[model samples]
Target: MFFRFACLLLSMLLFSGVSRAEDPVREAQAVIANQLSAFASDDAETAYSFASPNIRSIYRSETQFLDMVRKNYPPVYKLGNYAFGRSKLVGGGELVLQEVLISGEEGQDWTAVYEMRLMDDGSYKVNGVRMKRNTTSEGI
Candidate 1:
């Protein structure tokens, strides 16, 4: 009976750690999804809230950030549909590399790779994204 209890306790501990380890990836995905939803709704402030401190500093205001996205990342600003692709964790979970396959409202295909960082307060924020047009038949 003691051995069985010990084994059960050990399993519980191991499973709990596994869940904690997976939380960062799930949180990162949620942040990205929320930001995209905010963009879809034209909620500039909500979208900007997901950006890292570095990005916020550079853009200065939510409107400025939205304007930059509109002018430079048209596909992201006017997204039709998006699907998550590969993901990687780096620097002991301090950073996440997430690939997103995006279809623009105007039928253009693009690949957006996002870099998200863990903030000081234990929240994940999008540090940057690199958007590129899909040139090959394989698609993003």
Candidate 2:
């Protein structure tokens, strides 16, 4: 029994090699992309499913959440094209930022900071998202 257990452990460790950097980042990006796809399809219920438990609690209803998104994050609702920029570990969680280029505009750039957290089920969800655009600083 002891020998079998040791062999299993060794195999597990050896096969669980995720040393490359892009693996985790690519997984995270895929999650965000899928969730965003749900949004673009006007599937509010599906989009809400991707949100964290805390966010779901606050929003209460998918309709309310969709309304809020349409009102505040129109770019996200009507996305032209988006590209994943960078992702990093932050505060025991992961932060992934993406730039969404709005369509039908001469020059518009919007960057969204997506805060993701690992859940108890070993799945990641979006804790929150903050969007900002490019603008010159007048005076700070």
lDDT (CA) for every model shown?
A: 0.88, 0.70
Clashing pairs in 1: none
In model 2, where do residues sit more than 4 Å from their true spots? Answer: 1-23, 91-106, 135-140
Best by TM-score: 1
Model 1 spans > 4 angstroms off: 1-21, 135-140
Clashes of each: 0, 0
Which residue pairs does candidate 2 place in steric collision?
none
lDDT of 1 by residue, 1-140 (tens): 99999999999999988787667878898899999999999999999999999999999999999999999888888988888877888877899988888987667888888899998887899999988797322322
Per-candidate alpha-carbon RMSD to the true structure:
4.2, 4.9
Q: Provide TM-scores for the models.
A: 0.81, 0.72
